[model samples]
Each structure stands twice: as C-alpha cells, then as structure tokens.
Target: MTTHAPQTPGHPLPTGFPAGTMILTRRGLVPIEEVIAGDDVFTHQRLWRPVTAAMRTTAPTVRVHCASLASGLAATADRPFLTRVARVFLEGGEAGELSSAGWTRARDLAEGHRLASPLDFGKPVPVPDLPASLTGIDPADVLRTAGNMIRLKGEAAAALRPELVDWLAAQFGGYGARRRFPAWALTMPEELRTAFLDGLVNDGPQRDQFAVRMHSKSFMVGLRLLVCSLGFAGGLSSQGRPGKPGWLLSWKREGGRRPDHDGFRWHPVTRVEHGPEAEVFSLSVAEDESYIADGIAVRNRTERLTSL
Candidate 1:
C-alpha cells in the first residue's frame, strides 16, 4: 500500500471529495480521482471490499470540523457521515454521554453532534519472510541519513539504525519532511510490526500508552494510517487549530484490547461551513456501502442528488 495523488479514472453519483482527497485503499492512501473499479478499500467494518464503481462530480461541499478532527472533512451537504447525538436528558445541552449512532448528513451536523471516529484495529495481513538486507549501502551514508530522521539517543538510537532508516528512506522518501510507511512495512509480519511500532513509540513520551507528537503533517498522517492498517486503533490530533503545526499520534498497544464504542471514539463537531463548489469523487463498494475516510465512517450516495 502506498499514498497517491489525484488522477483521472473510471464509476456514479455520491457526494465526494475534491481532487487530492487521500482515500484509504488496499494500496495505501490513494486519491479518489485515481481510484478505479476492483480496487479493494478499507471499510468501517474493518474489512476489505472491492470498489464496484467510481464517479467524478462537481458539487457544493460543506467543510465539517470536529473537535478532535484535524483538517476536517469536505463533502457534499447530503453525504452521509456516521454520527450520533449525546444522550442528554437536560434541555438543549450537549453532554459527554452518547446515544445510538446513526448516519447524518454533513449539512445537518451541528455543534456538539458526535461523529464516529475510527479507532478500530484491522484484520492482519500475513507476510511470511522478511526482505533481505541491502549489501552495498555504506554505514556512514546510513548514519548521515539517520541524522535527518527522527532524533534518537541512547538505546533509542538503535531502532532508527542505518539499515532500517536506509531501507525506509529508499522505499518511502521524505525522511525528515514527510515520513511515510514503505509498502513492505505496511504489511510486515506481526513480529516486525511489533518491533516497528515499539521503535516509533520510543521516539516519544511513553509513560502509559504509546503517544508521540511530530511537526510534520504528512509524517503523522502516514503513521496514523500505518497503525490503523496494522489493526490498531490510532488517533491523530492536531495540537493547535487547523493550518497550525504539530500533530499527536497515539494508539493502543499491539497486544492490548480494542477501543471503547466498538473501536470508535465520539468526535464532537466543532464547525460546519459552506465550502466552495469544486470537483469531487465517490466510490461504490460491494456489500458494505461505507468506507473509512480521514478516520471517520462515511457512506457514499446510492442515488445522485441535484446541486445543493
């Protein structure tokens, strides 16, 4: 699996994202425009489903920002987003508690409405043998590259060694700027996944569960996808407001139990605004009509609607 940018491709009518919307696919985060029929994608069910169709659209979109959602989600107003309201008995007040979850439209979402944020772990993909080590790369070259990776010291330095760093760099460039998981690492064996996550945890404050903060948006985003891909509930939170720097990446330990609310956390909607009308994309999935987008459960439109 690898991340991709927008490109033309062939499918129908559903509320969709503009160009550059990164979708979680079997081949990693691929642009919706680039997605084609038969591409397997991760769904809210924590299972893989093949894409039945793809569609290009231009619609008026609503930009929805949740309390914990970084960058938010942009989709047509009628697009269904898995949401739930707090089970508050009081008059007109949002509470910490929640009620049964249901699908809600992006335009209908209001302040304090809770959206289902995916933290559920996924089914593991088996990898039998590990890749052979490189023979010609210089140790000094690797070390020099390591200097540009996440800073490590003491025992921590060993995890980001020349071999590992070199290997990762060669596969997924953007070492210090935009960290990404190499395709091999994304579907690595269970043992290697454990070691890889542990190494990442070592790069940050690890008092309770594994939690780390990084300034690189792409890197943190990639890490979030990596953890989620490995069947672990991963959460990415921006330290400041949108467009601001810094992101906190946290996840349950590999062997730990699943997250509460069936591996989903309630993300309160913070804002909803009228966004510009732009080109969007949508996909039709086989059986499960819903797919995970930016950590939230979003369903594609079964029937097309007129412009909002």
Candidate 2:
C-alpha cells in the first residue's frame, strides 16, 4: 500500500530529454542519449564543460518550440531554461538600461518568452603588429616560401601573394606539418588574416559553397578556430575515405544584430506543448549545471534540491 509522490514546480525532478534531442558538444551536434560521461558540452556561457555523469530514465516531458529551432526543445517539466525576463531602467542620475534574465522552469514557459541562444560565432581579433623576426623579410622570399608550401608554380603561384607569407609558414610550420596555430593567431589583423586564408583557398582544392579541404588535420583545426574567431560558422570534417586522406573546413556567415550578452542571443519561444511520458537522457556538467540542447539553454539536475 504505497502512494505516488506529488510533483511540484521547481521540485528536484530529474532533468533530461528523449533520444532524438540534439546536444551541442565540442565535436558538434550529437544525440543526447548517445552522449556519455567525460564528453564536453557547450554551455550557455560559450564555455565547454565535461559531462560528469550521464543517465537514462523514464519520465514525463514537454516540447518547447522556439524561434530558429525547427525541431523544438524537449525536456522534463521541471527543467530550468535560461530565459530573459524583462528590461529595466536604472533610476539614478544617469539613465542606464539593463536586461533581466534568469532560469525559468519549462512548465512555466509560454509563448513570447525569450530563450537565450548562443551567438553564431565570435568576432575577429585584431593583431597590433607583425612578428619582429619576419618584419624585415623580403616580399620575394615570403612569396616563394608560401608558393612552395602549397606546391604552387608559375604565374598562378605569383598571383597567390600575401605580405606575410613567410610569417604564415613560420607560424603555422612548413608544408604537411601538423601543428595548431599559436596563441598569437587569436589576434590577427583583418587584412593579414584575410590574405592568409585567401592564399590557402586559391591554392588548395576548388572552393565549393565556401568549403575548403586541406591535407593536415591540425591545420584544418587551427584554420577552423581562426575562421570562427572572425564570427563565421566554421565546421571541420575529415576526408576519411580510402583515397582521400585529409580534412575539410567549411564556413557560413550569420550576420545579425549583436546579442545583449557576448555568449548568448535571446530567441523567443513560439510554442510549448506537454508530451507523453517517455525515456529521456540527462548529463551532470562540471560547472554551471547547464548545457545548450539544439541551441536552447537548459538546466541540468545536478543537485538533489534546486529551487526556482
């Protein structure tokens, strides 16, 4: 003779989603149920947190449809979603505007509530000066080294010109060298950065829909990082077939107004529907107790008791 426990708003219910939900991770978008402990997921703060635990359970769930996310977000009713509540103005001598935001339970969410989405990508960093050692190098030598790196020859090689080709070779290593870009790559000036990328695209495989392929895995990784820092969506993949032994990097530009927070863009909720009970998955992140699923930020049930 046992009675069912009552569930209340903000109760410490387990948080998770059904099998089809996509979880954003460092590797890319992966199914939530497929994610295991020790995988790093992208958070609302634009940081990566390792999954401390992964669990599967049967529970009631809700489907939240938000702008820009076609499939919608599905999770337990008590799951906390990062939301923007309101806008407030300070009443001091100076008039300052601020946005009020916090975590709201899925059961309380409704149409028009703004959900925090991650920024498409970050902006390009500015490099103040060229490396001291490569500053005085002759343009011919730089051009020659750059051409040789990609096996370019003749008039086309001459056309593939950049002021800092030698610096690129030195910084990124010689041809076929597998090494990630150094720290200084985070602050490359626009002109020099563009020149470098253009040089590679021009000499490498034919560009198709803004995608480029390269032979070095580390080079592709570093190139993707640099491209992402320039506020473009840079996706990396490997050409892992029998004949193809290299990597591919593709990019797209998502131009829009900047979000209030550098790491998040607020997107409005379009629909919220309660769904039937089913199996779901959840993760215990190292910090923040939060992770973005299909671009929607949601809280994890890391603690036994979490208040609204």
lDDT of 2 by residue, 220-272 (tens): 54565456545554445556566545666776445432233445555556778
- lDDT of candidate 1 over 111-217, digit per residue (tens): 65777655534665443222256446543334233433444533455464544654444444543435533333445554555455655565322434677676555
- Provide the overall lDDT of each model, using Cα atoms, as 2-decimal numbers: 0.61, 0.58
Residue-pair clashes per candidate, as listed? 4, 0
Give the candidate number with the greatest TM-score: 1
Candidate 2: stretches off by over 4 Å: 1-13, 86-98, 120-260, 302-308
Q: Estimated TM-score per prediction? A: 0.67, 0.50
- Candidate 1 — which residues are off by over 4 angstroms? 1-13, 87-97, 127-129, 133-160, 170-173, 176-178, 181-198, 201-219, 225-259, 303-308
Q: What are the clashing pairs of model 2?
A: none
